[model samples]
Target: MATYNKRGYKPKTQKEKEEVVETDSATAEVFSSLDEGANKTEEWVSENQNIILIVVGVLVAIALGSWAYQVFRVEPRAEEALVESAQANEYYLQAVNATGEQQDSLYNMALEDSNGKYGLIKIAENYSGTPSGNIANYQAGMAYLNLGGANYQNAIDYLTAYDGDGSILEAYAAGGIGDALVQVDQKADAVSYYLKAADIQSNEFTTPKYLLKAAQAALDTGDNSTAVSSLERIEEEYPDAPEASTAKVLLAQAQIAD
Candidate 1:
């Protein structure tokens, strides 16, 4: 029969006072549990910090040993592989300039061993952790692309594996993957990569170009709204970029279509 928020109401009897004390006792139990847990945590940390430091020191020493091994042992092996790969690199450069059977021979030489030197695959295999190995991946992927045998998926695989950080070349690499995906009839996936490339920090050379391609792909897929949005972003965010002049025009056309 009591209404809510009847603040002036009183308990019917004196024993009702104990009911408030019971609620207060429950709250105190919660606070006690929290204090108990905090003390346990502090004690555990105090007891184990020395052991933790020793473990960390041992881990640091092991990591240093691994680095030393790489510097002394692995790097020398990679250097040897680089020397062994020189003939293959030369043949690849030659293949770039050749045609007919001469080109075929150079291509073959680039892929196969000659005079005890390693082919591209061998250099990649032996020096996989080295910078030269990563470059070999690019070189090999390009060679495969030039040869009529490369599938677009293979191009994407190599391009996505690019580990270069914070450079316009990485953006270009991402765009290359997008292009390869487009070549394989995967325009939707290509658009994602193109957008990713466009989102990276860039200047007049790459950012707007990739964004335009992404917007065009969006339009082809009946995503006119998204296409317009991307074009508008290009016009707004990159007014000085080469594609921006065209982007402004394209954005106007998209709005007309809308």
Candidate 2:
């Protein structure tokens, strides 16, 4: 027998031949490992198939339950709350315009259920997560504040719970809380809330009004620095506001106190 090499071809070296064998073995081991891992994964999944199915079923049930709750319960309740609050809101607005005993009577009507209609208090309590319910809280707080006396505590409770959507209502709610605190002689707390109201959403109407209130509350609490700052802000930012004139007088007083 005889062997011949082709032109420009060389026979394999021992080291090269060994390296080729090692490379092929390494490739085969990788493929074998992958196959083994796949088989184990399949076995594990088969063993836990029932548990996996139950988990998926529970997830689907939760998603459907949330959807049904929003559609059937929350949406209808929100609409109902809005409708129920209409009469109470009207009474509240009328109370704002009325005076003396008439105003108190109207505010009482708005606060309590009457003629089978849900009042602001009931609306706020029942539909707590809804938008109309939230507005009911604000209205109820204002009504209690107007009613005065021991109702100041109720006003504080309701106004403190109100969460406004970055609107003017937020400033009004803070200012309302401040008013209730002042009535209760919590002057220091009242000053902070008044300042919060003035800062929540700055505008000519609410900003100057709350700033002036904050200054007075601060002065009452002997917080001369806060009083001075609030009054100065009003003088500089809201010179044309009705509160500005009062703010100037308070500013001089606060400076003297400081």
Candidate 3:
């Protein structure tokens, strides 16, 4: 038929009319598919309304419970732990920084504060799940270690209980346990712990230091194989570390002993 164009009135060609019809059909098909999809979605929703509602209710309950737990339990406990830890932390610092008998005295005070409300042992015992408590475990372990005598086992126990983020503190805890084990005559386990400390985060400083310790422990146990291995690891992985030179000398000695 005839069609009016922007330029002028003109008769529609058969091809042009066919093209227009095809375009309309394609548009209609797209709309039909969309409508079908919408209808199916509505049908599914209607069919599974109870299930969907139950799922949503469960999700909402979980969210609310999580929020309530954090607010009512976690936050308050953390705050109290932090407050107690502040005093404990001061004592711990004093213990670590002091000298001679004063250091040991401060360490004892930190382990068993006079007030009894803020001490590493108390915090670790009472608030074992708190962050401050976790730190308390490490502090207590180190305190026991510094006290030396019969506290080596205590150091091992408390340090073994510590769980820290993958930080230098974790390395220190592992290394502390290794030292304690060595003192307790657990040569083999001490070697294992020293290697663990060196590998935990694998930094140039802690790794090489612990590796050197591992080598020494191995040598002490007459395990020339492990001594060589640890020393070689230090030379290969931490060649520029301060322990590297020492590690090389140790490796030479261990080789001769082997």
Displacement of the residue 183 alpha carbon in candidate 2, Å? 1.1
- What's the number of clashes in each of the models? 0, 0, 0
Order the candidates by lDDT, highest first: 2, 3, 1
lDDT of 2 at 118: 90
Would you list the clashing residue pairs of candidate 1? none
Query: In what order do the candidates fall by TM-score, top score first?
Result: 2, 3, 1
Once fitted onto the true fold, the runs of candidate 3 whose alpha carbons sit more than 4 angstroms away are: 1-37, 236-245
What's the C-alpha lDDT at position 136 in model 1?
67
Give lDDT tens digits, candidate 2, residues 1-258: 112133444437776556666766998999999999999999999999999999999999999999999999999999998898889999999999999999999999999999899999899999899998998889899999989999999998898889997789989999999999999889899998999999899999999999999999888888999999999999999999999998998899899989
TM-score of each: 0.64, 0.83, 0.80
**True-structure RMSD for candidate 3:** 4.2
List the candidate 1 regions with Cα displacement exceeding 4 Å. 1-64, 87-115, 146-150
Per-residue lDDT, model 3, residue 29, is: 100
| lDDT, each prediction | 0.76, 0.91, 0.91
Give candidate 3's error at residue 24 in angstroms: 7.2
- lDDT by residue (153-172, candidate 1, tens digit) is 66566666656575776787
lDDT of candidate 3 over 78-102, digit per residue (tens): 8899998787789889888899999
